[model samples]
Target: MPQFALEPAVIEPMVEALGFELVDLRVAGSAARRVVRVRIDLPGGGRPGHGVTTDDCRRVSRELESRLEAAGAVATQWELEVSSPGIERPVRFASHWRRYVGREVRLKAVGVRGKARATIVAVPDDAHVALEMEGAVVTIALEAIQDATLVVDWSTYGKREAGES
Candidate 1:
């Protein structure tokens, strides 16, 4: 079976069982030197604000290493890099939108209403994301979003507005 086919069938479940979400998996390099890069994220509430940790990566790496060895998934020596999804992480799937709901995001759509930067208000379903742009709420279909990610603006969150206490 192809590497792509093997990933969803065998690797994903194994990774998920270790309390990690498999973000992406890909096999690179020539036949002689194959590198299987598995990108993973911590389960919800893993950190104070849903961020991944180094310990989480270590745990996932250890578990995946043992499981892959027992299953004989890789014949040759391969490198494994288990790390957190850093700042500017790509929002590739619906789960991302759902996870990052209520946060400000920068999105670029393909052939829709051009690029937009807005706060994700809600994810009603897998098909669409409700956003607030310049105080105007809009629902953008998931298919229309070409790229997106949460934008952390500490200044906005830290400042005091012009109102009575």
Candidate 2:
């Protein structure tokens, strides 16, 4: 794999210091048009319309851009995009999974009978996640999970709109 200009070690601390979590960093496009896509979120977890905003992205972009320049991470011309991990944000890290305790998540994990949807009941130590499925708690190792995404509660919009009208 080719080395990226902006490694997580180089950008994580700078992002965390600004009170945000570095969800992911990817360098795409060709060498001529490098696109550095940085996905950010709140430190713990932000849900129900409380996630990172445009202002947050803008602030991080300006600060991170400056830091990257100082660190010589971006030597060539590139487009830096700082954005939030949308509603269906991918849950990868154990810490990220822990933050969504009591929230629903759709997981495509190994050893499971197709995709599973469950609410996170508990997050014990040692790379295991306890999920509530059919009123029962099922513990699964984090390594078994291939992909996981939070299920958006669209009903919340209905309640919020009803109160305003």
Candidate 3:
């Protein structure tokens, strides 16, 4: 069965109740090498730079594991991993675009191999984003985007953050 089948009944609600956003979930490998990787983010943020901590990951992991088992989402032995979306976090949903507006992003579209590095100006709607690429504002449909990841400028952000402290 597809992973989406369990979102409504298990994952989405559980993650929301924990005050976190579900970043990504991947179930890979075969029956013998099963792996379930889950990425989560704290909306209000906890750490200075990152929005989550080790404890948050552990807590979510424990809760999700129990829920998954109870829901019978996993029928066999599987390795579960839960972690925070790091500096280079993947933007998986339309909400993500609005959340990280003005941040540098790398977008990969279908039929296009190269990733476009640009700054997000606005999330015009759920299906499109306005980006400032090469000094020009361009709009791209979210559906055509295969993947979008935030590009962190650690040095710049760190320096700015330090000054504010």
Question: What are the Cα lDDT values of the candidates?
Answer: 0.72, 0.83, 0.79
Which candidate has the highest TM-score of all? Answer: 3
Between which residue pairs do clashes occur in model 3? none
Better of 1 and 2 by lDDT: 2
Which tens-of-lDDT digit does each residue in 1-165 have in candidate 3?
523234423576798898897887667778765788888888643344657889988999999889888877876678879898787888877788898899999889875469889899999899998889889998888888888898977676545544764
Better of 2 and 3 by TM-score: 3
The C-alpha local distance difference test score for the whole of candidate 3 amounts to 0.79
Ranking by lDDT: 2, 3, 1
Model 1 worst lDDT window (10 residues): 1-10
Cα lDDT tens digits, model 2, 1-165, are: 334467777888999999999887778888777899888999776655688999999999999888887767765668999999887887877777887788999988888778889999888985999998778898999989887888988766435555754
For lDDT, the strongest prediction is 2
Stretches off by above 4 angstroms in model 2 are 5-9, 26-34, 47-51, 74-78, 111-114, 132-138, 157-165
State the displacement of the C-alpha of residue 21, model 2, in Å, after optimal TM-score superposition.
2.7
**lDDT for residue 86 in candidate 3, whole number 0-100:** 82
* Model 3 misplaced regions, further than 4 Å: 1-10, 31-33, 45-50, 159-165
**Candidate 2, clashing residue pairs?**
none
Provide the lDDT at 87 for model 2: 72
